[model samples]
Target: MPGFLSLRTKTTSIVALMVAVTMACGGVMIWNTYRVDRLIEGMVSDSVAAYQAAEALETALVNQKGFMSYYVMDRNPEWLQRLGEYRQLFRMRLERAQGFAGTAEERDTLASIGDAYDLYVAAKDKALGLYINGDEIAGGEAHAGVRDQFFKILDHCEAYKKAHEEELFAARQAVHARAEQLRWVTVAALVFVTGLGGVLTLMLGRQVLAPLRRLAREEAGELALMEPNEVKAVTHRIENLIRSAGEAHTELARSRENLLMAEKMVLVGKLAAGMAHSIRNPMTSVKMRLFSLNRSLPLTREQEEDFQVITREIGQVDTIVQNFLEFSRPPRLAMQLESPSTVVDRVLQLLSHRLRSYEVTVEVKREKPLPNVTCDPEQLKEAFVNFMENACKAMGGGGRIVITERVVSETDGAGLAEISFADTGCGIPEEELEQVFQPFFTTREDGTGLGLPISQRIIENHGGWIDVDSVQGKGTTFVVYLPMDSEEKK
Candidate 1:
């Protein structure tokens, strides 16, 4: 007993170890599954409920506006009653939204919305009272205040809902990434365990058999010393091991579903890159042919116009292919420390002719003594040009474009060089704002839709980010934040 572990004792110990490991693994899997499920459920519930509440509030406000308009125009008591109903609904929705606030910022926004709504309601009521009592002039003046309050409420709601939606989207992306990592870990665990089990089985078999073979060769003495209790203990351990293995196998099977999702993503990226490369040569040849034909053609006005249209279409296709190639095979950045204001001024100078043609006014405001940013000057200028051109196109006729630059601290407290392009042009719609950064998404008929995406890529390559804020029918602003140091290079 002091010098040796018997074959029966060794087998029993190994079996118990396997059982304990399997049970511990199963417990961890269960706990992790539960935690992920609970988090996903909470995010979905809170996001859905918050959005619904905001939508309900907006709908109630719209209804109130319609009913108020009807009452003002026709002096209808029924319309007033409907207005009151909508007013109550609005208050209820506001309270529900307040309850659903997911963050302190959201709570503050909701409070501001509630205050604005209350003021609007008060102004509306006073206007209605005056109008009913035959003071149209006073009622009109009071109603103007209601409009201002209403706009403020809308602004607050929009900001609150937009922030929450972004947060929810980020949370969902994180959950997906975590789930993907867990899947890979589980697959790796299974493979490791299978290999380990096979090795252990072979080593244990040799160890147990070698002892038995030596005992058999030696004499009947060792065989006679083997106890019935030891055999029984070994048998019990084998039974437990069999049961644990069966349970572990079942749990692993359940966890192994959809193992190819990450593989599919990798395959898709390679496929896209291949497809883009394949299309580029053909597209360039077609464009060259079209240009050659356009120059060589001698035709009537109608024929020339038709040829020009075809040539333009071919050019557009080439541009799209070029964009695809650019995206799939990005050029290496030539980084250098340069003044952001200088880049902005150069881009503005290059676009001056186009801006003049479009009747768009350009203004540059630089916070003096701003630190130089590390970036590819040419690429940064390209990004600035894209933004300026986008602003001009958005305006259509004429507008003011303001380029502001300053050194600022990023969200992570890192020093950043900030440049903003604010334009008095038609703003992006709320629903479409987030999608603007996505490749091949555009609102314009003639747009290739890769400008913003390419600009975003360039900025991100330089270790920066772009932030956009827009209000429909008012204007749009794009802020680019680049690191002051070449940390990305390091």
Candidate 2:
């Protein structure tokens, strides 16, 4: 009940039912016709057999009369034999008529004819014997008796034929009646099926087709009024709006974080600048005084060792101050059209000694005819160096670094040249992946954590982006997508 059929299926089923009804009607008509035909055939056959039997009896009787006259006149033995043969033929015809009888009345009439025929045969035989024995008077009396019996037998044969004819007529009437009944029934069935089919068709048209046509008309009108180019333009604008909104949301969040980080960097830069200025003046005076003291008086071994340690400590502080200042305020980029592969090759060459010392294998993969990207070669090389050094540090014992370059097309119809740095080293955790680009966020004790932030800034300034994917136990991959076309350059 829940999965009831649609109007179309119901209509089709109704039509099929009508067709089946028509076929059933046709079958009934055929069966009735066959029954009637069989009845008529049996009646006709019986009638023909009865008629033939009557005709044979009449012919035999005529032959017997001719033979009796010949035998009575000639009184010859051959004439008596011919008379006997005709008598036998008459008896055979009566027997055949009895066999052809269909009804009980007809059989009774044939039986009576058989009894009369037997008496006639016996009298004729006696008459034939008397004629042969030279008693013509008694033989004539015997022949007279045979004629009376023949008339009675003839009457019975006529009755049998009449009965068959009556039966034939009755059978014809019954066939006509059955045929008439079949005709009326077939007509009624056809009318009923046709009427039902018509009603179903009308209902289907009203319920199913009418609504479909209305919907089609409405859709056609809408389509006719709309221009293809206008529709496409609207769709394109909507898609652009959606993409812009998403990008703006992501950029806003990133901007908030970057703003906080920039403020902190600015404050650190100011503090480092002040500290360096203050510390360098005092340290320069201390170095000058030491040089003057060493030149004025001779120094012992323990005293010289103490002087060397102080100098080394002062140098380490200066190095720390310089690193902080550089991290706070990076240098300006000198942008140019440079091959990414060339920058990568230069970095690998510069780090060759360090990489070999750590037993790290470096591999660069690039297809033929690599595209040049608009970027600062020095900045890009420095970024690559920082990535490679981090990879090498992660694999303290030994590991492999693979760099692959290729051209990729963005969904916005912009072409970008992508470089991927994949290292088989300990990877960052999933939780820390998001904060990897934040300044001063590092797992390493000696790491400044400003390397990735600086690298991300450099890539963004060149109208590009950086992405990372890593599994903690497996390895890490860093992908840089830079715009290849000049229009992308700022």
Candidate 3:
């Protein structure tokens, strides 16, 4: 009862079963194709060809014999020439039959025929030579023996023809056997189809209509429910169930919200753990540089540079902490009218050294001048910086990032400043794209996984959204769409 399909799967299965039955019927017919019986066809063809060859051998023999008789009557060399023609014809046909002979016995038969043919030719030539020499009595006597040899050869040919005729009959019988087998196969297929159809009918009646009938009787028994449509009755039942489910859903809605809040807290806690671990590497550098500055107070230029590096690392640590807190309790954006391109330019300049360290290059493409957007430039810069950092991390060692800025006019009397960051790097997997903004999910060991989430929060806080598209091995493109101010839209 738990797994019983509620008409949707059951009905689909019935249709599929019908298709399978149709395919089975087609498969049965396919078995009846001539390709399946090619062996029988080849046998029949070879038998027919060998039989014709034997018949032709006898024909050529007959033609040769009558010509010798005519040559005896007139002593015409033309008759002997014609006789030679028929003899050659017999040899040619015999060779063709030898090629088509399908068995060892047939081969021996052809060989014997050839030997006998050779003897007949030799004897016939001797007799004809005598005739041409004008010794009629001796030539006639020799010719009589030649006729007996010709008869012997003709008998061999007739026997060979008879053997092939039997082969022809056997081939026909084989064809009949195959046809009968196919007929039985077709009968089985029909039986299966008939049985499957019956089963389908029974299932439809008992599984589908019977449930409707039972529901109808239970609901309105009197007068057999006034003969209402079964579908209408079932639909009415489903409607009631759906109404009850709606009520139940209303009861659970608040609890569902509480559960989602709890899930977010758990994710935040996970991100906190990852962030605490990630801050150490930068903080450690900050402490070491501070110790160096304390030892060498009036520091050399290089030491002063180290002090500056410590300051920047401390700032980075503060930014990370600030981003984490901002993600927990999202603050209001400081909306200011500024070109989105300016924010992009600042982020690139800020990240220029980091980009070089990662061996990544950035190419910015602007479509004229971008429209001013109502957004917190700093927050936008933070988001853009995260985007570049993510791209650098994805690139790992060496790659390129192309940042494109443009204005898009919307249908609802608004314009959008679209900043797209396209990275040539190892891309995000398709399955994990949905969770990219979820806290503490990362593809690398040192990743805090807070960067993209904080970036997404900042973008969404300013009434914008981010779209990420990636192919597995190719790369990723992150497009940020922020609506422009009313003045810009006008």
Identify the leading candidate in terms of lDDT: 3
In model 1, how many backbone clashes occur? Answer: 0
By lDDT rank, best first, the candidates go 3, 2, 1
lDDT by residue for model 1 (365-482), tens: 8657356777799999989998999999999999999988877775676788889999999999999998897666799998867799889989999989999999999899999988
lDDT of each: 0.78, 0.80, 0.81
List the pairs of residues colliding in candidate 1. none
- What's the TM-score of every candidate structure? 0.42, 0.45, 0.47
What is the C-alpha lDDT profile of model 3 across 176-247, one tens digit per residue?
Answer: 877788788778777877877787778788888888788877864552376578767767767878999998
Where does candidate 2 stray beyond 4 Å?
1-255, 278-320, 486-490
Better of 1 and 3 by lDDT: 3
Relative to the true structure, candidate 2 has a C-alpha RMSD (angstroms) of 14.7
- Per-residue CA lDDT of model 2 for 68-174, tens digit only, reads 77766766678777777877888788788778877787787777777777788788788877877888899899888878887877777676667666766788788
Clashing pairs in 3: none
lDDT of 1: 0.78
Worst 10 residues of 2 by lDDT: 223-232
Worst 10 residues of 3 by lDDT: 219-228
What candidate 1 gets wrong by more than 4 Å, as runs, is 1-279, 367-370, 410-414, 486-490
